[model samples]
Target: MEPEAKWNGSTEQVEFSRMSPRSQGFTKLPGQKTCEKSVLLFTFVLLISVVLWGTLLFLFLTRFKKIAQDVEKLQESCVYHNDSGIVTIIRRLQVDQWDLKNDVPQLSKAVNKLQEDQTTLKSKASQISQQVDRLQEDGTTFRSQVLNEKNTATQALEKLQEEIEKLWTEFQRANGSVCKNCPKDWQLFQKKCYFFGNEPKTWPQAKFACINLQGRLVSIKNKEEQAFLTQKANKKGSWIGLRDLDMEGEFIWMDGSPLNYSNWSPGEPNNQGQGEDCVAMRANNGRWNDAFCRGQQEGWICEKLATC
Candidate 1:
């Protein structure tokens, strides 16, 4: 096995074997050189891409930061303006509230005063109404009293007028130049003055009283004269001039006149025990009756003719 020994042509194998790995790699095959060139070109392109990307990122960051700062300032300005507006609104609202508070008590006091005045007015109105009613009552009473007084005064005035008329009549008779004027309390009828005596007297006394007065016992001539004497006679009857003193049955007048007209009652002149001698009007109708001449008292009617 040790017997074989060989020799190269020029020791080429020995030099190649002796070369370093880096020297070996430097020496490439034909295809390997092409691959290496390709690799180098790829690496160069990647480095250029990374640099371009970084530059674009830097520009974007700067622009974005500037925009953010501007946005922040704008937001601050807006917030400040909004706060000022809110403050103004709040101040206005507070002022309004203060004004309302100040006016509330005054309004309430005014209302209370109005209510009190209304109450006072109501009381005064009621009092005025009552006073009016009282005044009306007083007026009614005064009117009634005035009416009564007027009625009484009217009656008194009428009575006084009647008395004045009577006085005037008396004055006319007293002052006039009448044919047959009557004295006080005497009445004139036709052409004669007549007196109706009030005192009770016997026939003789009655005759004397007539003579003193320039009159005689009434001698009724006719129906008219009888009616006048009857009207003047009292209710009990009054004595006339007719009597039967000179004769028992014959009747005559005191003036010496015969009995021309006689108005005798039914069944009268019976002489009644022979004492009835004088004639008197028995009733208001002028009926005649014989009465006692001397012993009995009687009213008498006297008459006198006119001398004018």
Candidate 2:
């Protein structure tokens, strides 16, 4: 409500009832002008909002089309690369298989050649072994043949020597003119002549008799000669050429031959009385006994190399 204006006796306040209330009020009214100004401001803001949303929608659709084209190109490129890789791998595998097939025949031929060489070597080795065996057998046979020939030659020589000795003995007996060969009474043995005297004599006399006969007192050589002299002994002891007079006990033969053999009667050479130094042969077994050189009279044997 408006306060009534004071009627203070002024000329402007002539009649209060005659004027309208709005005109009579002291404040001015803002009715139709304010409503028109508000409506114009709201319409301008709605037009600006619609223009901005439409611009954003057009930009979004353009970007989405570019992304879809890029995705399709990428898928095509991957498929092409996969096909190329598969073809390259297949070609390489085929080349390797062909190379392996070409080498197999050459390897087999090399193996066959090696086997043939091995067989040839084996055959040659067997031939060499057989030749060696045959050579060994021939050598053994040749050795045996040589031994047989040697034995045959030795036997023939022995027989021829015996016949020559017999012929020489006969020739001396017939001639009897101070023969250069053995005399008639002497016995012939291997390359030597031996004489056995009948009468007994002291050892000194026996030795001198043999020297006079152009020979030395006997020196026994081997068992065969011993047996021969034993046969000629006729159960009588005989003086032979062995003594130890020079050294007392070490006996030696007259011809300076080594005393390699002995046939002493057991306990015979005891050097009894130190006088028994000369050797005497026992007639029974051809074993020798030592006796005094000047004491006993014993038959004696003499020996010399034969003239033939």
Backbone clashes in candidate 2 total 0
- Residue 153 accuracy (lDDT) in model 1: 86
Model 1, C-alpha of 105: deviation from truth (Å) = 99
Q: Write the per-residue lDDT of candidate 2 for residues 35-124, one digit (tens) a residue.
A: 888898888888888888888888888889889999998888867876679657878888988987898899889889999999999999
List the RMSD of every prediction in angstroms: 31.2, 24.6
Against the hidden reference, what TM-scores do the models get?
Answer: 0.41, 0.41
For candidate 1, the lDDT comes to: 0.80
Query: Could you tell me the TM-score of candidate 1?
Result: 0.41
- Pairs that clash in candidate 1: none
- Poorest 10 consecutive residues by lDDT, candidate 1: 1-10
Runs of candidate 2 with Cα error greater than 4 angstroms are: 1-181
